[model samples]
Target: MPHATIVEEFPKTALSRRTGDVLAAAATGPVCLTDHGKPRFVLMTMAQFERLSGRTDGRTEDWTRDLSPEEQALFLAEIDERMCDI
Candidate 1:
């Protein structure tokens, strides 16, 4: 199991910085960010991002490694499930 970090982007950090750090952490765990006292975005690691982006590294991608069709599908499903509440 992975440990997630939910951060309120107000007191100590801004949305942009947290957003960057969240990407790295997202590869390892879920990073939930908030704005205006409400949850606004969810971030996940590379694998999770890959599932979501279908591009191996989302928009800021630097490298590429193809995922098997089955693996990609499975991971994409996991990302979906992770994003769900209840």
Candidate 2:
């Protein structure tokens, strides 16, 4: 879905109290979750994730094929690290 650049921000505690509201905001665009008054996390819908990850069908696009072996390994490692956070 197309969305505006505007991102709704909320403190981390809001996730515990206003969970529904936070999710509702995320449906429209990315939601910024702050920790200790500092921007920390972003929440987005699954469709946005699939689109950003370049997964149209069951498989993902081979955009990394052009990268060198070492570069691809480094990129894959970074992707693994980020996925662990989920």
Candidate 3:
């Protein structure tokens, strides 16, 4: 997969305090962790990592297309919360 241009970003502290949300966001694309407000780490699915690292063919799937209504709502809510934090 091509590197996701629109990656989700959060403070490094969030990785421990909000691991679930970080992971949920990562499921869609890369999650960028910032330490002292500088980009530090990128979290992505193993498949994505493999594809980007040339360990696998570039075929990809859109798992988000299968999200249930409730799951979609939760994801949106998390986005809203992140927006509020901004």
Which has the greatest lDDT? Answer: 3
RMSD after Cα superposition, model 2? 12.1
Please give, for residues 37-83, the per-residue lDDT of candidate 3 as tens digits. 99989987665566577786433334334777456545545654575
- What would the TM-scores of all predictions be? 0.34, 0.57, 0.62
Please identify which of the two predictions, 2 or 3, would achieve the higher TM-score against the true structure. Answer: 3
lDDT per residue for candidate 2 within 37-85, as digits (tens), equals 8999888755446655665453323755677755554554455457668
Tens-digit lDDT track of model 1 for 7-65: 32332245465654554444445566666667677755446555455654353222223
Error of 1 at 2 (Å): 12
Q: Is candidate 1 or candidate 3 better by lDDT?
A: 3
Q: List the residue pairs that clash in candidate 1.
A: 26-44, 26-45, 27-45, 27-46
Deviation of model 1 at 23, angstroms: 2.4
What C-alpha lDDT do the candidate models reach, one value each?
0.49, 0.67, 0.68
